[model samples]
Target: MTLRAGVLGLGVMGRHHSRVLNELEGVEFKGVYDPSDAVPSHIEGKPVVRDLDTFLDMGFDYCVVAAPTIYHLEIGTMLASRGIHALIEKPVASTSEAANELRDLFTAAGLVGGVGHIERYNPALQSARQRIQDGLLGDIYQVTTRRQGPFPGRIADVGVIKDLATHDIDLTAWVTQQEYVSINARTTFRSGREHEDMVLAIGTLSKGTIVSHTVNWLTPFKERTTIITGEHGSLVADTLTADLTYFENGVRHHQWDDISQFRGVSEGDVTRFALDKKEPLRAEHEAFRDAVLSGDTSAIVTLAQGAAVVATAEKFVADGLEHRLTTP
Candidate 1:
C-alpha cells in the first residue's frame, strides 16, 4: 500500500524533506504547508499549501513536521487530532513540556510519531553502535563528541545546546544504549545573539560511562566526530565523512624503559571499516516510513527520547547560567 505523505515546512531542512518524500518508495508526496510568502507556490512539482486546515484536508497518512522548533507542538497536536502520523524534527519541541505533551497526545491517539534525530541513521554511527553491542568495545568507558561549525544564519530561536549539542546528547545515549544521569555545562554568548553560541558539557550516563560534548558556532571549519573509548579499544566515527576507525588496545609490552613506565594502555593496530555510506536523511526517512507502514517503532527515535534530549539541553543551559563566570 502506498502511503500519502506531506511536509509542513519549506525551509532548508523542509526543502530537502520534500525532495526526498517525492522520491521515497511506497510513499506518495502530497505537498507542503508553508504560509510564508517567501516560500514558492510549488515544491517538487507539488503545491505549496498556504492554509493549515486546507493542507490537513489533503488526506495524508503521515506528515513530516519540518517546521521551526516553535511550531512543532502546534503542528503535531493538529496532526494527532486529525489521526495522522507525524515525524517531528529533533529536539521534538522548543521545551520539554511541549515535547511531552506531543508525546502524550500521539500516544493517547495511538498514532505513529517519531522524532527526526538523523544522526542515529549515519552509517558510521550505526556501525559503531553495532560493533559496541557485539562486544567489540567491551566495558564502554567514555564517549566524546566534537561538533563545531560556523553559525548558520537560519537559526535564531534556540542556542547551541539545543541546536547542535542535542545531536551529541541523543547519539551518545543511543550508541551506548544508556541514558544521561547527570550533566554540568558551561556556555558563552560570543556571537552577540540572544542565545548562547558555544557550549561545553560533561555528563555521566546510567551505566557510569562518562561523556563530554564540545559544541560551538564559532569554529572556522565544520567537524562532526564521535570517539567511543572502551576496554578493548576506541571507535572513532566521523559522521561528516561516514568513516569508522577502530584503534585496538596494545597488548604487547614496551621494550623501552620510558615507554614501559606509561600507566595507560598503548595503541595497537588501527582499522577503518568499509561502510556503505547511505545518505542519512534518506535512511531516516526510510526508517520512519517503515515505522508508519508497520506497527514497529524500534527503528526510529521515539518522541520520549527526543524530549529527554531537550530536557538534558535545558539542564546544560541552566547549569551554565547558574555558574556564571567572570574574568578579570
Candidate 2:
C-alpha cells in the first residue's frame, strides 16, 4: 500500500524531508504547506500550498512537521484533530508542556505520532545500540556526548540545547535503553541571542549510568560524537560520519608496580566496525512509515519519548538559569 505523505515546512529540514518522501518506497510525496511567501511555490515539481486549510485538505496519511519549533503545538493539534498521523521534528515542541499536549492529543486520536530524532537511525548509533544490548558492553558505566558546531542562521526559534543537544539527550537514553533520572546544567549566551548558545549538562540514568553532554553553537567545526564506556570497553560513535569504534579493556597486566597501581584500565585494541551508512533521515522516514502502516510504534520514536526528552531539556535549561554564575 502506498501511503500519502506531506511536509508542513519548507525550511532546510522540510526540503530534505520532501526529497526523501518523494523517493521513499511505498510512500507518495503529496506536497508541502508553508504560509510563507518567501518559499518557492513549487519544490521538486510538487506544489507548496500557501494556505493551511488547503494543505490539510490534500488528504495525507501522514504529515511531517518540520515547521519552526514555536509552531509545533499548533500544527500538531491541527493534524491530530484531522486524524492524521504526524512525524514532528525533534524537541517535539517549543516547551515541555506543548510537547505533552501534542503527545496526549495524538494518543487520544489514536494516530501514529512520531518525533524526527534522526540520530536514532544513524548506522553507527544503531549498531552501537544493538551491540550494547547484546552485552558486548558489559555493565554500562558512563555515556558522554559532544555536539558542537557553528550556528546556522536557519534556526532562529530555539537555541543550541533545543536545536542540537536534543539529539544527544534522546540518543543517549535510546542507545542505553534507559531514562534520565536527574540532570544539572550550566548555560552561556555568548551569541547575543535571548536563548543560550552553549550548555554543559550532567545527568544520571535510571540504571545508575552517568552521562555528560557538552553542546554549543559557537564552534568553528561540526562534531557529533557519543562515547559509551562500560565494564568491557567503550563504544564511540561518530554520527557525523556514521562510524562506530570499540576500545576494549586490556587484559595484559602492567609490570611496573607504580604504573599498575595508577592505571585503572590499560589501553586495548581499537576496532571500527563496518556499517551500511544509510542516510539517517531516510532511515527515520522509513521507520515512521513502517509504524504508520503496521500500527506498531516500537521501531519509531514515539511522541511520549519525544516529550520526555523535551521535559529533560526544560529541566536542564531551568537548572542552568538557576545556577548561572556571575563574573567580576
Q: Can you write out model 1's per-residue Cα lDDT over 53-169, one digit (the tens) per residue?
A: 999998999999999899999999999999999999887999999999998999999999999999999999999999999999899999999999999999989999999999999
| Residue pairs clashing, model 1 | none
Question: Residue by residue across 22-136, what tens digits does model 2's lDDT show?
Answer: 9999998989999999999998789999999999999989999999999999999999999899999997999989999999999999999999999999999999999998999
User: Weakest 10 consecutive residues, lDDT, candidate 2?
Assistant: 258-267
Q: lDDT, candidate 2, residue 87?
A: 98
- TM for every model, in the order presented, reads 0.97, 0.97
The C-alpha RMSD in Å for every predicted model, in order, reads: 1.7, 1.5
Ten-residue region with minimum lDDT total, candidate 1: 258-267
Error of 1 at 192 (Å): 1.0
Which stretches of candidate 1 lie above 4 Å from their native place?
254-263, 326-328
Candidate 1: what lDDT? 0.95
